[model samples]
Target: MGDEKKRKMLQRIEELMSYGEPTPTIEPSLLKYLDEAALRGILETLERRREKLIEDEKEWLAQFRKEES
Candidate 1:
């Protein structure tokens, strides 16, 4: 795949993070792994990519559908 296609593939993973999803609940004992700021920043980046993927996918699908018809 070309660079654009590679970017598009990555967008699929990003799409999942953009939506509000329940975070993994950690037990009080494992709280050492918690990093709210890091998590938030990652989610912010994902949210942006997710939005773009959604738009691109819609166009991609529409074109496919039209071709099939």
Candidate 2:
């Protein structure tokens, strides 16, 4: 991919990492050398982690509510 496309993907990855818990940390310098497939893989892995975190949070909330009864 072109430099512009890589830059945009980097931005998206950064933005995704900036959100709530269970985020992965990667060095920006290392990311720049990777191809689009690698970048997408990273994004997909992070997305899966985020989904797991959300699921765990929902489970915790449900447990908490159950205990309040």
Candidate 3:
């Protein structure tokens, strides 16, 4: 992917990440320019990052509970 397209993809991924929920279905218009491989790569990367965020948040909450107790 070109730098500009990559940047836009990353930005959209970040927006999805901030939603703090499962990744929503990407609109076809937004993805029309990318091939299957690029689309898969973006989805996989987003899923991995989202999983990490959930794990980190869980750990943080656990620690907070420990401190409170």
Candidate 4:
């Protein structure tokens, strides 16, 4: 995916991760149009990237605490 589109997708994913949206918000029609492999790959990639971002955030907070102390 292109950088701009990928960034947009990540933004949406971040929002969805919160207690804001309903599960399985994807519509049936969109699913029908999507290629199964592509969709699965995108989802998996997003999931991994999100995990890494969370880990990085935690590390940053820990470092900040040490500096404060």
Candidate 1, residues 2-27, lDDT tens digits: the string is: 44443443343344643555553333
**Clash count of each predicted structure:** 0, 0, 0, 0
Best-performing candidate as measured by lDDT: 2
Q: Candidate 2, overall lDDT?
A: 0.78
Worst 10 residues of 4 by lDDT: 24-33
Model 3 TM: 0.55
* Candidate 1 ranges beyond 4 A from true positions: 1-34, 65-69
Cα lDDT of model 4 overall? 0.59
Local distance difference test values of all predictions, in order: 0.53, 0.78, 0.68, 0.59
Q: For candidate 3, what is the lDDT?
A: 0.68
What does each candidate score in C-alpha RMSD? Answer: 13.0, 3.8, 8.0, 9.3
Comparing candidate 1 with candidate 3, which one achieves the higher TM-score?
Answer: 3
lDDT, residue 34, model 1: 31
* Candidate with the greatest TM-score versus the true structure: 2
1-69: candidate 2 lDDT, tens digit per residue: 887887777777876787844554556677568999988997898789889989999998887674544
lDDT agreement of model 1 with the native: 0.53
Candidate 2: where is the Cα deviation over 4 Å? 20-31, 66-69
Show pairs that collide, candidate 1.
none
Q: Is candidate 2 or candidate 4 better by lDDT?
A: 2
Write model 3 residue lDDT over 1-69, tens digit each, in one string: 565665577566656655755665455356557765775587688888878988999988887664543
For model 4, what is the alpha-carbon lDDT of residue 7?
A: 48
